[model samples]
Target: MTILVEKPVLALEPKDVSNKDDSEKEMAAKNGFFAPEINSFGNSFRDYNAESARQSTVEEFYRLQHINQTYNFVKRMRAEYAKLNRMEMGIWECCELLNEVVDDSDPDLDEPQIMHLLQTAEAIRKDYPDEDWLHLTALIHDLGKVLLLPQFGGLPQWAVVGDTFPLGCAFDDSIVHNKVAKQNGTTLPPAALFIIRFHSFYPLHTAGAYKHLLNDEDAKSLNWLHIFNKYDLYSKSKDKIDIEKVKPYYMSLIEKYFPAKLKW
Candidate 1:
C-alpha cells in the first residue's frame, strides 16, 4: 500500500496544523523560526539562552498576503473565533501565555515575554488616561498570541500572533513589511488580529477596514493601538524594562476592563 507524506513543523500545511490536539498542537506550535507561541507557557524560557539572526527582504511578505488573504478568508475566520468557544478563559492567563512570542531569532536584548507586554501597556497608560479602555487594550492586544500555547488554545503562529492585518482582503504594506510574513509563510489570523486592532466600539480612525471594525468598546480602546504600536515593535531594546516599577499602574487599568483576577 502506498502512503502519503505529511510535512513537519518547518513546512506545515494549514490543514495539518488545524487537526492537532493540544499536545500535538503544542509540539507543532514551537517551530521557532521566529517565536512560535502555541505550546508556550509561564516557564518555557526560565533557563534563558540566545538566538540567531535572520530576516527577509520586504518584498516577499506583501506578495503572498496580498494574494492569499481575501475578503472571504477574513469573514470566515472572524466567524470562527468569534464563537469564543475555542478558549473561554480569563484575560490574565492569556496575557502571560503570549510572552512566548519573544522572537529569540532577533539576537537582541533578551526581554522576558511579560516585560514586553508591560512596556506597551505602561507606555500608553502614561499618556492616555481618559480612554480607560485604551489601557486595557494595550494589555490584552497581544493576548491572542497565547493561542500558541497548549494550555490556552494551541493554535499556530499564523492563526494567533504576529503583525495582524485585515485578512478578508489584501495585506497592507504598512503593518510590518519584512522577514516574518515573508519567510515564515503566515501571519496572525483575521479574527484575533482584527479584534486587537479593533474592538467594536468607537474608533481613533485609520484607512480602509480599520474604521469599520469599531464597536463602542473598540472605538474607546483603539487609541492605545497607536500608542503601543511604537514601543511594541521598536522598543525591543538592549535593556530590559523593569516590570515591578510599572505593575501598579497597569493593575489600575486591569481593574477598569477586567475584574481583579482573571479566570483563565
Candidate 2:
C-alpha cells in the first residue's frame, strides 16, 4: 500500500511575517534602497567584458594578482602582516582614513571609499534591522583597503583590493583582511568573520569554485556570506550616504564588538 503524508507549511507563512517587514520594505522603496538590476555604469555589475576606462585597469589587476599571489608569497605576507604593528587606532578612525584611499579595481563607482562603506552598511541595516553585526560587517568590510595608505605600508592596489583567492593548486582570487580583524580582537561570530574574510571571494561564493575545501560549518556560513555579498556589490552607486547621520549608530556597534583601538 502507498501512503501520502500531509506536509506542513514550513516556509514563512503570511501570518508569521510581522508588519515590521512591510514597513521596512516600504521604507526601502521610499528611500530607493532596493538593489538595482544594472550598475551605475549602465551595465551588469561585475561585467569584466564591458568596455570602459576601468575595464583595462581591472583586467590588468587580475592578471598581476593571479601571477604574483603564489603559495609561498601568501604565506610570507600572512606571517609578516600577522604582527599587527602597523598602527593603533579605533575602528571609527580607520573609517576616516579610508577617505584618502581609492579602489582602482572597482569598475562601478568612483566615489570615496567611505561612501561605499556607509551605503553598504545602511542598505543591510534597512533590510536586516536586528542583525547589528551584519550592519557593522558591511561598514568595515573594506576598511582593510587602508593598506593602500602611506602609513599602512602603501601597498599596491593589486595586493590590497580586488577579488582574492587561495594561492595553491586550485587557485581563485579574493581579498585578504580577516587577519586584521581577528588579530585585532574582534568579538564578532564566525559567520561575520567568514563574510568579512571572503566577501570579495567571488569565485567561491558567486561561481561555485573551491567547494571541495569547505567544511559543513563553512557551508552554513556561506548562507550569511551570500546575503552579505548582495549588499557589498549591488549597493555601489553614485548616491552619497550622510556620514554624520549614520556615524553614531555604527560607533555603537564598533564599541560592542572591538576594542577602542586595534593594532593595524
Q: What are the per-residue Cα lDDT tens digits for candidate 1 across 1-264?
A: 853333111111111122456676556435411222211222222112212222231233334544455578667777765555554444565665655665332223245557666655655444444444545555666565555677645654344433346544443444444233311111222232344654311112333345565577554334434434444443344445565676666665554445444333
TM of each candidate vs. truth? 0.51, 0.84
What are the candidates' C-alpha RMSDs?
Answer: 18.7, 10.0
Q: Indicate the worst ten consecutive residues by lDDT in candidate 2.
A: 8-17
- Alpha-carbon local distance difference test for all models: 0.44, 0.78
Model 1 whole-model lDDT (C-alpha atoms): 0.44
| Model 2 agreement with the true structure over 43-162: per-residue lDDT tens digits | 898877799767877777766765666678778878877889988999999999888877887887777899999999998776677778888889889988998888988888878888
Off by over 4 Å in 2: 1-28, 171-181
* Leading candidate by TM-score: 2
